[model samples]
Target: MTTADSSVDKGSVSAVVGDKLSGRVALVTGGTRGIGAAICGSLAAQGAAIAAGFSGNVTKAEGFLADFQGRFGTAVTIHQGNVASADDCRRVVAEVIEQHGRLDILVNNAGITIDKTILKLTDDDWHKVLDVNLSGAFFLSQAALAHMVERGSGRIINVSSVIGEMGNIGQANYAASKSGLFGLTKTFAREAAFLLERAGKLSDDSVGITVNTVTPGYTATEMVAAVPEKVLDKITAQIPLRRLGRPEEIARIVHFLAADASSYITGQVWAVNGGMDM
Candidate 1:
């Protein structure tokens, strides 16, 4: 049985929470603030160690570490790096493993948007969005997958957007990048299972790796806060819920997928949108 598949009895409750994610190491990019921050807190509450990734904001990074340690009282280590850089992605994974001993969950939550209409979008704008949003997820997943494959157990979760499904004005580049995640996630999901089977890791009672995506609607985050009030109101009116999502709402689903009981779930996209799909 894999680490996640191992059964825990009442006596082991102090060691690892039953049916919840515990004794796992998770690495989350863009994890210091916004939606990523909420994800970290959710996982930490379940007793997982966190390796929070961020760019180069020293002050914010320091505060993030302090706050999480105080709030959840869990083990957390912050890593600074550019997710767009493949070298940085590999290094961060290595560092996390070195610090935490092993990595069990990887959340590709870091993303950037360079919104502009197709006609107005420049090559740099398109590439930058793709590099950070799409390619960053790929590079980081690739590195994480290598370690996961060797160990024969892990979970990779990608964070996408509702805008990827319903395209918006002046966001052609952003939409394309987010949409690309769908294919990326599904392919990762299939390939992970195949590799595990090839390595002779699967059995009637044993489980292997899983990969999935979480598409969140416009949430009450700093990024969504930048939208003009009129524009935000129009967006809200389209939702069946008649309001934006909470970061914790999205975090809850992610926590589910990361837990031991979700072993059968893989290659799926969980959309936490209001009614945007309809």
Candidate 2:
């Protein structure tokens, strides 16, 4: 196990409860900004070494990396690649393992959406969304599982959206991609369970690997910043909380599912939306 030697400075929050994830190595895709950035910060604060993956925006990524290092004194590596490509996914996972020596947490947080009403939606738009959001998660999980299985432990946290559960207008492609994650999570969990059982290690106390999905609802992030004020207002009004979710709030839930305490919570979709779709 990786040792926890970093100290939390005044700028950052304290470790979650018991520093439950201390010493683990985490790979967070799309981690340079917004929700992904928050997830990286939260995990690093809890003493996990972070490998942040970004497809572009080197300036933002550099800033995030510097801030993470300065605030938490955590080890962080920046990887540049498009998650939708299988070869890129494999390379990123390999690089993280090479740098950190092991992979314990894989947060498939990278995603994109191309919104258009079904009649107006082009085939390219549909394929692009599915490629990045659904296929990306699958490819990354496949790459990480090799190392995870070898160690007999790992956490795979896929970021889904509330649209997956409750459909949204102009988001058919996005909805489909996110909905696909639920099935993927359950399928991966069952496969891991079978492997553990075959090894005589399947038990409540020793579930080998945990795979879960975090679905955030109407979060305040760059992904949704382009929505017009009227549209944003409508979305907030529908939410019981009367406000959009902060990225950090979503990150907190992801952090929880990534910790040792969440060992029994595999194959579950933990929604962080504020009563948007209970």
Candidate 3:
């Protein structure tokens, strides 16, 4: 079925077409594949200009950018950078603002995983996972917040994982990073709310911002493709839905939170895991 007809394709949060996000710009880290790419495509379809940030993988980034521009006729830009690096995060966001003039949405979706017992997991493994998964989000959000605060409006969506909420067998590093992300989300939400409240108290007419997180379950992404088929089947059997979720499903939620529909929601974690741990 076309995405238009599928239940998963709820499309944009905008009730009207063509101008739901008429003047908004969004940046998604690691937006070249899997859920990240899906969020970009979905947001573009909703009329938002999109900027995609990637650590490497120029080929995939270019291809997706072309596909998005061709399909939706929206301007889509791809940026190459190490999200774990504070400098790179600033560069990516600065370029986007230079091109589009403002930043409205930021999704911290780039992450990595190393599966091994703590006994075997090296310091390198632990640090790498935390660096990409947790630190990347912190740095990018910090940079983006500066712009959003200046504009007096924005949305930040951090992509966490169900594993972070309910610990997995051999994902100590991944779990810690994700759990930290939840904490980060809370702090961001509190800070944004406080800033907006203070602005309101001062009787300023300014657009406000919201921050939230989405934790996805086992999806058919490249990372999960690396798992053994038997392992995949075993994992699927544990989900209440008896299946894996599509990237688009998670993307829809991200888009909603990015849009005005979720203006009242923040500091929350939405789990798209098909009841995997429930």
* Error of model 1, residue 250, in angstroms: 0.6
Can you rank all candidates by lDDT, best first? 2, 1, 3
Give model 1's TM-score versus the native structure: 0.92
lDDT of 1 by residue, 1-278 (tens): 00111233435335223336777899999998999999988897788888899997878888888766555545788899998899999999999998778999999999988777889999999999999999999999999999999998999999999988888899988888888999999999999999989999876665578899999999999899999999999999999999999998998899899987788999988999987786
Q: What lDDT tens digits, residue by residue, belong to model 2 across residues 1-278?
A: 12223455534544343466778999999988999999988897787889999997887787777666566756788899988898999999999898788999999999998889999999999999999999999999988977887788899999999999999989999999999999999999888777767767666676379999999999999877999999899999999999999999999898898888778889999998999999
lDDT of 3 at 231: 95
Q: Against the true structure, candidate 2 has what lDDT?
A: 0.86
Judge candidate 1 at residue 81 and give its lDDT: 93
- Estimate the TM-score for candidate 3: 0.91
Error of 3 at 240 (Å): 0.5
Model 2 weakest 10-residue run by lDDT: 1-10
Every model's TM-score: 0.92, 0.93, 0.91
Q: How many collisions between residues are there in candidate 2?
A: 0
Q: Of 1 and 3, which scores higher on TM-score?
A: 1
- State how far residue 65 of model 1 sits from its true place (Å): 0.4
